[model samples]
Target: MEDDPDWGEMVSRHIGPHQKLRLHQVASVPEWAATADLSRYDLIFIDDSKTSELREQTIRHVLARVAPETVVVIHDFEIPPYQNAVPADFERIAFSSFRPMTGVVWRGARWTMPITQLAERIDARKHMSPLRHSAWRRYLASGTGPAR
Candidate 1:
């Protein structure tokens, strides 16, 4: 499910021609969760870019319902509140790129990489506008850190 129509359109344009994608646009995550069958999907991705805690709660709900083998990816992984929104049991798989930074969470299985190794790979860099990056850096420095 996609939260924004513009993003949905962008995704449609990029993958629509090459892949058969079933895109569903909802007003918010909670709306989607109400009707979606959690076990039907093998993968789930969320644009957890909102600063709202309610959005985080919705994400948590989605995570709770997914199967253990399901792969969940959260974008804007470095943003303050969003970055701290993941569940405690899930392991973070941070990528090398920080722009529109990405990270993975696996709740049903053991993480293939150790924490130290994963830490080495999550390179924090510019992912958003300069102003937003500055603000996010300050937010992290405040010691709130990631939700894990």
Candidate 2:
């Protein structure tokens, strides 16, 4: 999800896209979350919030709606109270991004083969290149599967 249309395009270019994917250029993600049927998506990427509090709220809203197998990728995951906001029952894995940091969170039996494979392919050391040298980038670019 993204609030700004231009940046949202850049984000879409960065992550590639899923046929089942849904993008919401919403004004208030929390408000949108309040009514959105978020359960249908297999993978979700959130670089939407503009502040720390909104970020936490966005995550909580997503967590409340998504299924256990849904892949929730959050940008700037290592930030202060943002990290604190994540509950103990969920599992999060950090990786590189344009922010120089990103993380994917999930609950339940999250060790699904695709999820585990994505984690292994991601470069923990560098941001993705639009040129497609990154395995993780290529993996998504190919539309091989959802991050789940």
What CA RMSD would you report for each candidate? 9.7, 5.6
Cα lDDT tens digits, model 2, 55-97, are: 7888777877887778888878778666666678888776643
Reference-based TM-score, model 1: 0.63
Q: Pick by TM-score: which candidate is best?
A: 2
Off by over 4 Å in 2: 9-18, 96-99, 112-117, 123-148
Q: Model 1, range 4-80, lDDT digits (tens) per residue?
A: 78988988887766543587777777667755678977778876324466567656777778777677777766666
Clash count list over all predictions: 1, 0
Cα misplacement distance, residue 112 of candidate 2 (Å): 5.9
Query: Where does candidate 2 clash, by residue pair?
Result: none
Score residue 118 of candidate 1 by CA lDDT.
Answer: 46
lDDT of 2: 0.70
TM-score of each: 0.63, 0.69
The TM-score obtained by model 2 is: 0.69
